[model samples]
Target: MATLLHIDSSVFPAAGSASRAVAETFRKAWEEQHPEGTVIYRDLATDPVPHLTADAHTAGFADPSAHTPEQAAVFAERLKLIEELEAADAVLIGAPMYNFTIPSTLKAWLDNVILVGRTAGDSPSVKGTPVTVVASRGGSYAPGTPREGYEYVQNYLSAVLGDMLGLEADFIVPELTMAPQVPAMAELVPLFESSRERAHQDATVKAKTLAERLAA
Candidate 1:
């Protein structure tokens, strides 16, 4: 059966999180297409993985047999995360922008799973796997917008997830998410609604399409 590695790093619940809400939509569509498929779900906000440590970092380059007890223990945890990524056929991430970048939880997860020789180098184990990231943000950062240069979420992920890991990365962005709540941005609420709706539609279509492609 197919497998999806679904990760959500939103601190808020689905009702309050644009990324979580859209990610759930995509997951539902994916599950509908593959009734027997497996979804390895990780709620990073609730169960955040450990941040990378020196022991874990050095162990990746050292031989397993030579690892100290501390390195061994930390590296074992890292391997579990890397193996999970290797086992997945597809990946979905809810990367809501937090202070102009992905949540620290999501970054920690990446730090754990990314190993030099196995998951990040030329022959990455999960190379070419499709990853869909729901990159939600509070303000508009589309090209030509005043804050376009501040759009580090997508740009950073593209480099890390695509250039480094070699995954086929795609993004479904829902911007201006704060317009409805921020009085200063109240005029952009309509744009937020439109973006949110389009994000849902994109998630649904992409989920179904990818599912069908995998089945074929």
Candidate 2:
């Protein structure tokens, strides 16, 4: 059976988080299409991945057999995270914008998965892995918007996961997620609702289509 790696990094609970909601919609569609498929769910907010550090970095580059006790320990964690990615047929990530970028936990996960000689480098290991990102932004950042170029979540992920690691990534972005809650964004409430609804609709379509494609 196929396996899907579902990752959620929203600090807010599922009910209040737009990214997580979008991801849930996709999950439902995915489950409907693949009843027997396996899902590996990771909620980074409650169980955050440790941020990369000097030791982790050192261990990632060093030969596994030559690693010191501490380095070996760190490398073991990296191996577990990479194994999850390598084993999955598809990936879905809930990435809400936090201060114009992705959550630290998600970034930490990325750091661990970008295995130098294995997943990266000249003759990379993993390639064409399909990834869907539920990107929820608090404010608008589409083309022509004042903050048009300020969005980094999609760009960063695409660069690292797609361009660098050769993963095939697509996104369903829900903009102005803070419109209903933030007083200053009250004027954009309608836009927020529309964007959110559109995201869910798109998620359904994408999820079903992806399932068909993967099954074939």
Backbone clash count, each prediction separately? 0, 0
Question: How high is the CA lDDT of each candidate model?
Answer: 0.96, 0.91
Predicted structure 1: lDDT = 0.96
TM-score, cand. 1: 0.99
Over the stretch 1-87, how does candidate 1's per-residue lDDT look in tens digits? 899999999999999999999999999999999999999999999999999999999999999999999999999999999988999
Estimate the Cα RMSD of every predicted model relative to the unseen true structure: 0.5, 1.0
- What is the RMSD of candidate 1? 0.5
Clashes of 1: 0
**In candidate 1, which residue ranges exceed 4 Å CA deviation?**
none
lDDT of model 1, residue 56: 94
What TM-scores do the predictions have? 0.99, 0.97
